[model samples]
Target: MSLLVAWQLKDRRVLIVGGGEIASQRMDSILVTDASIAVIAPEHRLNSRARQLIACHHARITHHDRLFLGPSELHNIDMVLTALDDPERSREIVLMCRDARIPVNAADIPDLCDFYFGAQIRDGPLQIMISTNGNGPRLASRIKERLQRALSGGEGEAITKVGRLRTLLKQKAPGIGGDQGRRRMKWMTRLCNEWELEDFAQLDNAMMKSLLEDGWEKDRIPSLQDVGGTCSTRRYHQNFHSTIPLAVGFFVGVFTTALITFFRHRK
Candidate 1:
């Protein structure tokens, strides 16, 4: 780990050196970055959705329709993503980017890449990064799917709340670290869990403000046991009627079958 690699393409120019399906996939990732993109390819082959994206979005991709990597093509490019089917062309693009000190991502070729795109889940200001370390993309994708199931939609909002609370704690409880900091964070996290804020988005700003102001004090912490007990009681009561109706229906069906069988035997 001698290298601590980081690249900033925010609001910068992104050049892609291919136009096939592989290049189209890379285009999707770069689009999210809001980077000004230009794709240079000799031909065009894309799905309907992909074609729509390139056409409607700010992606400034222009197909070369010619097999050549001219020096003029590198004009004002900050980053390059090479996804050409030909390894030799990809290698050449990497070399050009290296000489120019521009960041390059070569798909399916770790040796030629400056950065590897990982499975990323963005929840507002919260980001969960999952990387396979260039070993197994299938495993990375599997983990990403699980994370999506667990943390997408409302999950992101919950995490954002946690982050805001942590920031507030750090600012409010200065110099508190080790056991004290851990205890404070643990308690705040537990409060979130107990509240199940996923279902309670209407928590007033005043209450959130108060929580941030007084979250460090143990006395201010809400009773988790009482909250959980109430939730459980409510669930049981709500489902009790539904359960009874289903049970009665099942028994009636069984009894009717039994009666039919007995009458058939008598006859």
Candidate 2:
């Protein structure tokens, strides 16, 4: 099976060989990241959409108004995508990338591909990817559509808001490999489990600050009834409340451990 990974593409250099609709679609996906893109294909061969992508993202994208010349083009490139109509040329680029030790995605050429784009769902910073391992892309697309339909937009919003909370938590806890970090992780994990998706979605700046405050001083995060922002689905909300006792027990265990460590160190 394929080992799926979420690659960090920020400020990385990526080379795209071809300027067709398919190539442009691949380009669109990366445009969401901070990658420096290089598009290689004759200016005359570029489709309208491809041309538009270059025009809009000229600062981020470098368009070469000519076809892939040789191996020299692969220099300093971290990744490559070949979506060429010319099978021979696509194969050539794939082989070249392989020689240069760069991961490559070869459209319609599964055997040559080091990676597959798969079917992807994006909810701000949260991403869910479904891959059939080059078996059925059409099936993957259908699955993605179904999943997207099931998600409330709140799923994305909650993640975005929680991410901001994490940033604030870093200031209180500091380095990620010490006692303070351990406490921070346990506290964050407790919040994520005890709070429902709806609960997280409703968090305002004041509520988040209150959460951090409670964790630090009071050692208690309040119930949704006390906070009054969400719990829109009664059935799911009830289910979540049922699990809170167990979650709280876990947090309490963590707190007890921290206290024991502190007293032991002091003695």
Candidate 3:
């Protein structure tokens, strides 16, 4: 299974080994991350959009205006993307990236890719990335569209509000240490589960201040009984019953052998 993860690419060095439309698509995606991007392709081969993007981000991007030469070019690069039309050159670039211990994505060649640029949906601090394990990018894009619509409401703003509330709770709430800390955390979690973005988003600053001032009152706080039982409680007994017989038999056999050996030695 391919492990999905989000990379922090801010100010990191990324090298792209093509300048056509495919390369431009990759460039557009990478540009948003504010990475130090360099495009290595002949100036004549570059598409108009690619050139424009490079020019716009000239401060952060370095256009080589020529084909990638050797593995030496891969030095100090955190990630590499090869969108070259020539399969042989693209394979060579992938090999060089492997040798340099750098992660690379070879465009249109799933076998050579160390990573795939999956379809993503961004909502303020929230980001969702979807991948089909390189089997189908089109399907991933379709799913992304569905998710985009699903999250079109105030989901992002709700997360931001929860974050702000959490910060306020940490600063203002007294008895937030020891057992009280866990109680506060459980109360906050319950609040998050019960409250929606609209619940707090419509409130004025004065109302918010008033709510915080009230703190964790017995009436306002969710009861511990309301929380669902833990997985351990549900599964532990089942596992213990299944394994105890085997465990007991193994221990009995060992003890029997030991006792027999001791009797034999005495004889």
lDDT of 1 by residue, 177-216 (tens): 7876777767776776666545333333454566654545
Pairs in clash, predicted candidate 1? none
Which numbered prediction scores highest in TM-score against the true structure? 2
TM-score of 1: 0.59
Off by over 4 Å in 1: 1-7, 42-47, 59-68, 146-153, 160-267
| TM-score, prediction 2 | 0.84
| CA lDDT, candidate 1, residue 117 | 79
Report per-prediction Cα RMSD to one decimal: 6.8, 15.3, 15.9
lDDT for predicted candidate 3 compared with the true structure: 0.77
lDDT of 2 at 66: 89
The global C-alpha lDDT for each of the candidates, from Candidate 1 onward, is: 0.68, 0.85, 0.77
Q: List the residue pairs that clash in candidate 2.
A: none
Candidates sorted on TM-score, descending: 2, 3, 1
Against the true structure, what is each candidate's TM-score? 0.59, 0.84, 0.69
Off by over 4 Å in 3: 167-187, 198-211, 216-267
Candidate ranking under lDDT, highest first, comes to 2, 3, 1
